[model samples]
Target: MANPEQRPIGDVSVPLNTGDVRGFKKEMGRLLEDPLGGAERLDQFLGLNIYTWVELPSILGILFTMEERDMIRHSGMRVWDRDSQGPDQGDQKWPMQDPGWNNQNERHRQNMSDLQWMIIRGIREAVPKGQNLGKAVSEHQGKDEALEDWLE
Candidate 1:
């Protein structure tokens, strides 16, 4: 038999429901806004973090919310204006709308990959010995699949 550690976790897909999408988006946005606070961070709380298949939908959902909220302006990313791409139109920007992060390029998505063991090691180095470190690591392991899948 394969060792438990060698076994693959079941696949998790991002749900298509709007509310779920919205909730996930909000949660991720909250995380990105501050990668160092809240119960969520109680899990694997440090790293450049990559997205996994499971996390794709929610991340995209959050990106959509940011777009709608204008929290991320396309102009800042140097994307062409929507109207500018076509004939004379209103003040809309980025004709061919796309995902953005903290008003940055989709490249921010790459941050996920950088968030690996190095980050965990960094956290271990920063925190003291008796400050719920074990609990933090345990919780983060539980969420690893979810987080990793989202990055894909």
Candidate 2:
């Protein structure tokens, strides 16, 4: 039988690498301290690897609990900014105006969204039968707010 600690990505299953996950988490922590650099590092970390993309959500689920995943999403938002404008700077150069930068920014935004979806989906999949997933997450968060609140 396949080890429970191993997750399938693409055509193969491999055991999780603690060192790689630790490095990724370290980069995530840098997001708040350095937005542009952190984003660049995260993009480079993910690269163009199919295996990384396929395994990312599962790796994230293993590395963090639902609450921690939610926090990571929030931290990413603070850095990436949903609109892609990032933190406002009156006189600063607008990197998004460049076609290349704009494309990269959009890709990053999509990546973040995808990761968020995976986290929520994982949570939903873990919910007990007949139990409302939204309520369960809200309760875990210590609130009575709607699921959208958690999503946002």
Candidate 3:
């Protein structure tokens, strides 16, 4: 059996309903407006000693909620806005007019990868040069896909 602690990226796609998406979007908007507070909350979530803040560019604003953050803490999945390609278009979801979405599974995968990278990048920016922050972020990124294999 595959070790429960180790999961592949393909296995970590989360099944988010419309409501989950909406709530996440709302919180992201609020967080964008207040980077410091968001950083504090994220630091809490990440259990990091450093107080790092990010000024979410107006073009980039999608983020997973604290609740969902906990839900997928080690699940290797995340919520993201795939339509705008940046984060401006939360209104366009899967099976909508967005190009190439085509199906629900595809949509979930898009957001999962996008959000995961966003989280990784956010941490990379916050960590100082000598702290081996990349290694730190990779630890979480390297966690075995504890979530169910969604590739099937």
Top lDDT prediction, candidate number: 2
Query: Each candidate's root-mean-square deviation in Å?
Result: 19.8, 17.6, 20.5
Which lDDT value does model 1 have at 106? 41
Say which prediction, candidate 2 or candidate 3, comes out ahead on lDDT: 2
Question: Which of the numbered candidates is closest to the native, going by highest TM-score?
Answer: 2
Candidate 2 weakest ten by summed lDDT: 90-99
TM-score to native of every candidate shown:
0.21, 0.31, 0.23
Residues 38-105 of candidate 1 have per-residue lDDT tens digits of 22342333223344423433433443444332322222122222212444222222123332432122
Ranking by lDDT: 2, 3, 1
Q: Count the backbone clashes (under 3 Å) in each candidate.
A: 21, 0, 4
lDDT at 97 for candidate 2? 29
* Predicted candidate 2 versus true structure: per-residue lDDT over 50-120, tens digit per residue: 23333555655655666655655454433334334534331121121222222135454444444444333
**Which ten-residue region of model 1 has the weakest summed lDDT?**
74-83
Whole-model lDDT, candidate 3? 0.37
Model 2 local distance difference test score: 0.45
Question: Scored by Cα lDDT, where does model 1 land?
Answer: 0.35
**Rank by TM-score, descending?**
2, 3, 1
lDDT of each: 0.35, 0.45, 0.37
